[model samples]
Target: MTETGAAGASESPRPRDSATVMLLRSVAEPAGSGFEVYLLRRASSMAFAPGAHAFPGGGVDRRDVELAPGWTGPSPQVWAQRLGVDTATARALVCAAVRETFEESGVLLAGPSTRELVADTRDEAWERDRRALLDRSLSLAELLARRGLVLRSDLLCPWSRWITPRGQPRRFDTRFFAAALPAGQQARDVGGEADRAAWYAPAAALSAWKRGELPMLPPTMISLRQLAEYTAVTEVLAAHRDLTPIEPELDRVDGRERVLLPDGTTHPLR
Candidate 1:
């Protein structure tokens, strides 16, 4: 939540619409929690949250708002009701969630039909398509249409929404989503914006952040805290969430500026 070496600006930039997916899987040997979440360490050279551990996501692309790709599972109308957006925007957000997760994690959430998932995506042809998606040369719609696949929107569960605190150099109004890693799909270190990728039990990740071994933004930290309560991925997917947007505010605490979250916790604003 804190931005170092930059003075606060008087006017805040409008937040960009973005989507983030927290990919999870059940762990056989529990380490403080029964499930582990996938996280990527942003390359230090990135402008935003450099070196921080985050989920696989990015800003919604213009193509995401284009004609909808083949889709199954929950309809966009239902998603609009759940995500608090119009049907079109809801579809775009869901498309972005699936596209970003696949681009960053090598795990596709789409399949030939509603009841199936792409078992493996490590083939040479798949990698070529993935690279095209990453570089903006391919659209998710076109990709799905060509391959006779449909996006499995039901694979994703709405978690929460967060807005970057005002006055930062960049900001995003991001919808957080939770999804179980699909069976037979493996998440690998497909580096691009991230320097490394790994899975961590929710509690263990928080412990690492506390020990200064992992740095995270408030949203990621808070989401992990929530996830740590569940013993199974199914429990997380079945849980209902209140999706009111959380935007941190600036407050002066004990002579130092800090970011005040809706829960009243304060993070030092460096």
Candidate 2:
């Protein structure tokens, strides 16, 4: 462990459980591009991943749990098996994924029943609920129950997991999820922690990162690389994935700071 903060002072990393959603949609333009993934640039004033392009996510809320009301689709047991976590944790992750996706982006992955999905969430009432959720004054379970809706857990696909390296002031054990944008719904910049939000083709985002035009954390970069491989949203959701968690290691190589990935590749720290 580096045992030092970004300022070289000894600091212990406190990793929080988080869930991120990769929202994908099919686009007709740009001939070869099949899909676009939503990306949000965190406000520079934010405490974590400032100014970095990332997926919609945040730490799991205390109220996010298996006891949530009106959950439909795969059971928590199935989610537990897929995420390789306890049933309770699996439930929370799923709830967090749905809640955060709605909070960060205006798209809601829920409906009045299992066979249906909420098509639009742009109304003022929806915005009030979103704000209440963000402020922690409202719980997902309560919102769903009040609205007579069910969480559409079937919409989420488990993709990957990554743990922030130790020694950083803040760290996240974030589970990545992929979901196709619901029909009749559009993602709008709900601007809070993020300065801007937009959809970009996976390859184009990677190119921007490479050119230093956009900053991306390793996990974001890796996830984008993975998404770039598929031509359609169905291909991504249909692909099999290994949910093994990844924790990069920091080491000194020839007196240079470097991060060693699980695949044994090393990326020099900037």
Candidate 3:
């Protein structure tokens, strides 16, 4: 653990539980990769990782644990086993993943039934509901119940978990999830915390990061590298993942501090 503040306390703050989704789509154009990932550039005014490109996600809402919406696919017990958490916490995390994806990306992983998905959410009513969700006026459960929809838990695949390194004021124990862009739905720039949203091939994103164009945190960079290995969205969803928690450590390298990943890679602290 790293010491912080003027008093130099070694205790790190407890990380807030958060969720992020790597929304992927298959592209017809052959470039660096056949699939592209959805990314949002966080608003420069934001407090944490401002101006950095990240996925569609946010901290889990407390209401998420209190409300039980219509659900499909794997049960909460199954998700608890997959996420290595309690049943209620697992349920909230999964709900938060879907909710944040919808709140940030204008993409909803919900449908009327297990066999069907909401095709288009571009209507004015949908926009109102999205805004409501963002403002905390509408809970995911309430919105789904009103719209007669069920959260498609099967659509999401747990990819990885990352904890913010000590020394950062804002810390998040974020679980990364991957889901395919459902058919008939499009991801638009639903601006809020993000100023811009776009799709980039995993290799292209990594190259841009190397060029210092697309600034990202270690988790995003590592996830992009993993995504670069797959040529199709189905491949990513089908791939087995080791969901071990990766908490980067702050280490002194050549007298300057650097963030060290579990794989022995070091990145300069931003």
- Clashes per candidate, residues 3 or more apart or on different chains: 0, 0, 0
**In TM-score terms, which candidate is top?**
3
lDDT of 3 by residue, 1-270 (tens): 442221222566789999999999999855767899999999999999899999999999999999999999999999999999999999999999999999998899999999999999888999999999999999999999999999999999999999988766778999999999999999999988999999999999999999999999878988999999988999999988989999887766556666788787787655
| By TM-score: ranked, best first | 3, 1, 2
Candidate 3 or 1, higher lDDT = 3
Q: TM-score of model 2 relative to the true fold?
A: 0.92
Residues 1-270, model 1: lDDT tens digits: 443222564578999989999999988854667789999999999999999899999999999998689999999999999999999899999999999999999999999998899999988898999999999999999999999999999999999999988877789999999999999999988899999999999999999998988888878988999998999999999999999999887666445667788787787542
TM-score for all models, in order of appearance: 0.94, 0.92, 0.95
Q: Rate the local accuracy (lDDT) of all candidates.
A: 0.90, 0.88, 0.91
lDDT, candidate 2, 1-270, per-residue tens? 342223432465667889999999998756557999999999999988789999999889989963575889999899999999899999999999999999999888999998888879999999999999999989999999999999999999999999887666788899999999999898999999999999999999999998987788888888999999999999999988988889886767555666668797765442
Question: Once superposed on the true structure, which residue ranges of model 3 sit more than 4 Å away at CA?
Answer: 1-9, 252-257
TM-score of 1: 0.94
Which pairs of residues collide in model 1?
Answer: none
- Winner by lDDT: 3
